[model samples]
Target: MPPVQTVATIRRITPVGAYHHLVLDAPGVTGVRPGHFGALAIGGRDASTLLRRAFSIHRADPGTGTLEFVFAEAGRGTRALAAHRPGDTVDLIAPLGTPFPLPDGPVGAVLVAGGYGSAPMFALAEEILGRGGRVAFVLGAATEDRLFGVERAEALAEHVYVVTDDGSAGRRGRVTDVLPEAVTVTGATEVHSCGPMGMLKAVTEIATAAGAASHTAVEEAMACGIGICMSCVLPVTGPDGVTHFLRSCTSGPVFDGTSVRWDDAGTLPDDLEGAAAMTPKASHR
Candidate 1:
């Protein structure tokens, strides 16, 4: 289905350390899946900010017609968004991009997240639990305050592992440092991850080594949010065993971990299967 532009009323905004969690009342909006994102136009329609800022859907309550998203003050766009008050109306283009695929039957799965990348995992955990499947989580960040959902994960997941880089939280290490052990302890058959590209790559390697199926929601800077601009492209192995540039905003944000060509992600290598055939034509004299 095509995306819809809706005027959503801001319910409230809560500050969690350096991040702002915004909840909006979006009635008539439905079918929002975990890992889907929203492109919100901040600073009002007549304000200086023209482009919409994209954020992963943190949580959505269909019954209440409310949607939640979190963001840190990265730049002008986000700072403008933070200045908004309750009762303010924000334009939203929501439930965009592909969602994390579900397993065929109930199976133990491990979810790994870094920083605010954990935004989408909670809703996903709820879905998995509803289907009689069990879920475990590994949450990591640079500091204790950056870890957003540890307490919630502790309550929901069968097991929760927290890690921080500065030794200010959980184990003083990366998620990869403890991922293998978590997979083994939970007897996980699948691993789903959303974080930095490097972290996702590491998780893919670890999960593969453990003989577990891995899926990941990639983080790519997007301009159009939808796929028209072709700004967010990544190399992915096609079904025909050839590498192709897939749009992250449309073809995915979620893809099979094994199908991604991580090393050649941003570049088209000469040895790539279809690289030669896709060469550009010379300019006319």
Candidate 2:
């Protein structure tokens, strides 16, 4: 279904660790799926902040017409959004981006997350479990306070592994440290991850090494949240063995881990498709 531009009333805003959990009564926003995101207009109508902020859909309840978003106050826009009170309305365009692809048949899967990236995993996990698949979680953060959903993961998944950079949580390392063991223990044949790009690359590598398929939801910066702006483009390898810059906001936020050109992320590869066409011809001597 096509996305809808609507005003969502703030149901509540609760502080969760180093993030804010926002619940909105969004009536017209429907067809939400795990890994889908929403673009929220911030700073009121006439404010100078024209670009909307994009966030992953943490949870969506179709019956109640409610949507949940988890975000950190990383800048002025997010800080202003967190300051909103209950009953306040915010302009929203929701259920955007490609969602995580579920397995065709029940299978063991491992979900990996960093910081509040764990937000969408619970809903994904529920969907997986309902389909007779087994779930395992490997959550990590800089510190214990930065971790998002340990309790919820434990309550849902068959196994849960926690890691923190400062040793303030379960294991004293990145989520990749314990992921191999988690995959082995759960016999997971697939791995799904959401977090920093560096972490996603490592997770993809590990899952590949273990003979498991990897699906990653990238956290690339999206200036427009829609396909209009070319700001959020990234190098992605097409099936034809050529690299093309694809817009993260429209083409994907979730992509097959193996398809992303991780090594050439920030820099445009010299051999990328259309690279020669974009180069300026040598000036006449």
Candidate 3:
């Protein structure tokens, strides 16, 4: 949001399990909100991965102009991030997308994250707690090895729940297995979830039935990261009677779960209606 600053270099890189945490010299752009993301341009100029990779702002330092980006080490793009040492300048188009709005109530929030989804929610947890709200984090992974940032999340939230499918960690089941317990024990009256499509769906059902407000963060293979390219279209019901396809980039990584057409995850139908998309041009201005 500040005047165009030079590309901030990576000050440090630390590997945390399956994800890498990068500290960049992003000063004026540090006061970013939760759910808003930035674009990090890495790799050589000739590399096929020229465009910036969209990363959720995990931590920010407005004073120092530094940022912490947490990303999974899944492919060449991320591997490029992992390979960065100190003193490397990475171009970033930051502070993009709308933020998650904090709902008011005698509200207790339960954040359910599958894996790296914890990065954004952990940042959110601190804000919620600081505002006198409460949170219980329910984390899930396939096994103990797949679990990441347990200690930090536990520290951020008042309470924590870990669920692993292979039984290698807290409980031998899906993350949903711990929801009822989390709600009952922590008295978390609202829910926010980000993870695999299945887990999000399950949480949606649970929260819907319990009469709890719920939000979901959707994941996809993004091209522009901004909404210029329509590669990330999703189906949604609009204000009018017709349902439509929307852009995932600018409209959301976060959306009201009930409003999202979950059944259309990987394969959005071509003719879906109410297809308004909030491109970066719209969100930034």
Instruction: Check candidate 1 and list the clashing pairs.
Output: none
lDDT of 3 at 268: 44
Expressed as tens digits, the lDDT of each residue in 56-163 for candidate 1 is 999989889999998989899999889899999999998899999876678888999999999999999988888888989999999999988888899898689999
Cα lDDT for residue 230, candidate 2:
83
Which candidate do you rate higher for lDDT, 1 or 2?
Answer: 2
Kindly list the per-residue Cα lDDT of model 2 for residues 1-285, writing each as its tens digit: 778999999999999989999999997888888999999999787998889999999999999999999999999899999999999999999989999998777989999999999989999999889889999999999999899989999999768999999999898999999999999998889999999999999999999999999999999999999898888888999899999999888888998899998888888788999999998899999
Q: How many residue pairs clash in each candidate?
A: 0, 0, 7
Residue 122 in model 3: lDDT: 78
Shift of residue 66 alpha carbon in model 3, Å: 1.3
Error of 3 at 25 (Å): 1.1
Tens-digit lDDT string for candidate 3 (1-285): 532434888898987776788899977585587777778777857778876788777888777888887888777888887888999888887777656667554468898888777778877787787778888989998878677778988788767899888888898888788887787776776788877777888898888777777788777667887789988766766667456667777888787787777887656454554223432235664
How many angstroms is residue 142 displaced in model 3 relative to the true structure, after the best TM-score fit? 1.5
Backbone clashes in model 3, listed as residue pairs: 26-65, 27-65, 243-273, 243-274, 244-272, 244-273, 244-274
In order of TM-score, best first, we have: 2, 1, 3
